[model samples]
Target: MAKVKLKKLTKKFKEVLAVGNISLDIEDGEFLTLVGPSGCGKSTTLRLIAGLENPTQGDIYIDGQKVNDLPPQKRNVSMVFQSYALFPHMSVESNLAFGLKIKKKSAREKQEKIRWAIDLLGLSGFEKRLPKELSGGERQRVALGRALVLEPKVLLLDEPLSNLDAKLRLRMRTELKRLHKKIKTTIIYVTHDQAEAMTLSDRLAVMRDGKILQVGTPEEIYQKPKDVFCAGFIGSPPMNFISGEKVPQVKDKNIMVGIRPEHLSVSLTKIAQAIPGKTSVTETLGSDNYLYVDISDQLISVRLKPDERIPEDKSVWLFPHQGKLHLFDKTTGKRI
Candidate 1:
């Protein structure tokens, strides 16, 4: 395993700056994920680290060695793309042995390495099957096995689970976590799915428009977001933002108040010092129901239990939990 570092890394394609000046340090054997919306430069950053794309400026260091001019093969890293990219013509064993063959390892060495990969990925029974014969999850495991056979010091995964179905994606995520725990290889993962980023990463970097907005543990970022954009981007239903002037007891009228759906409770009866709103909609998702309350021109979402019932008149009051209100400056859109 090896530690990776980026110093003022930047990449530009003519007028488009796909990745701006960004610096980060990834510890050896750590699973770090870069997450954000589409076209947010997370993929560009991953490619730069994998030696697939040349940076416009700054330097990359792997295992304390500068490798700005090194090719992908010399970086001792393996990348698994979103597409499985398996060889339809070759069997699973052959696909796993392809890279070793190019490296010109002995026949016995190749066989041993292939066996190790197959066992590690739980693919012993499917070694002779072609890509067409395997399910999506099996094919994904084959792709991962192909990379693992090389024993790379670092692994780069770019939305590897995006192509699978929802249930399959969840299963693959669990397998990935287990694999990381067993091998402890340094992994740099890129994905736009917040659920994947939160569940898989030891630490996550939130990016936007070619720049990193915030980097922290999932809990830290969700609980105390530094900026309005990050606060709204990291949550499931996202945070509810209200103009400070419209809410009672707000000391700063020129600010915005942010409260997560779980932080606000709906009261059926009118109460003093509570914000009044009309129940606009309710969404039922298994165990929890999300209630959307319209407060004048703004809409607020509140999390409710499945058993909770709304009033027939559609009248409700919003009560923000104490010490849960997030205050942001209106002009700067920054937490205050």
Candidate 2:
């Protein structure tokens, strides 16, 4: 295991700043994920750590040693790309042995490492299979095995499961968590998928426009977002934003009230501090229903039980759960 640290790391593509000056510390054996929308620099940050991209400024340290000038091979870090990058003509065993062969390891050492990785990744039975013959998940496992056989101090993954189907992605997520537990290698993963970040990471850093907006555990970032963008971006179905003027109890005129769909309930009868609106649409997803209501000039979504049905175009009252209310400064977009 190794601790990875970045100090004021920055990357530029001529006139474009792909990664702004940012510093982060990844503890030994921890799984840290960099998550954001496309063009947000999460992938660039991971590349910098892997020595695939040179930093425009600042320094990178792996296990307390400065590696700014080290090449990727000398950095002792392994990376798994989105494409898997397996050789089509090579068998799984050969692909996993390629790196060790390049390093000219003893034949016994190479065999031992290959066997360990294949067994760990559940690829033992498919060692003789070519990449073309493997399923998507199996190919992904081969890619992972290829990286694991290298036995690097740090493992960097760049959206390694993005191409898989929904069910396969879910299964891979579980496998990855299990793999991390078994190996305990320090990891830095980059993905735009918030669900994957939340589920797999020990902690996650949310970035935008080449800068990190927030870094925290999934629950911290979810329940107590620091700003408007985070509050709106972290949750599923997104958070509902209402102008301060629309909420009479908001004392500050320059503030906006944010409430999650799950925190708002629709009521058939009148309730205190409830806003009246007409149901615009109702979406049923088996376990729960989402009710979109038009209030004033804005539309807001409220979560309801599957059995609770609000007819479209029918009037209803929406009430925010007092404990779950989030208030943000409208101008700065910062939470109050």
Output the TM-score of candidate 2: 0.97
- Per-residue C-alpha lDDT of model 2 across residues 1-336, encoded as one tens digit per residue: 899999999999999999999999999999999999999998889889888899999999999999999999999999999777899999999999997888868999999999999889988789899999999999999999888888999999999999899999999999999999999999999899999999999999999899988999999999999999888888888899998877656756799899999998898777768888888998888787899999987899999876787889988888888788899999999988
Residue 24 local lDDT, model 1 = 91
Give the poorly placed runs of model 2, Cα more than 4 Å off: none
lDDT of 1 by residue, 86-112 (tens): 989999999999988878788999999
Q: For model 2, where is the 10-residue window of minimal lDDT?
A: 244-253
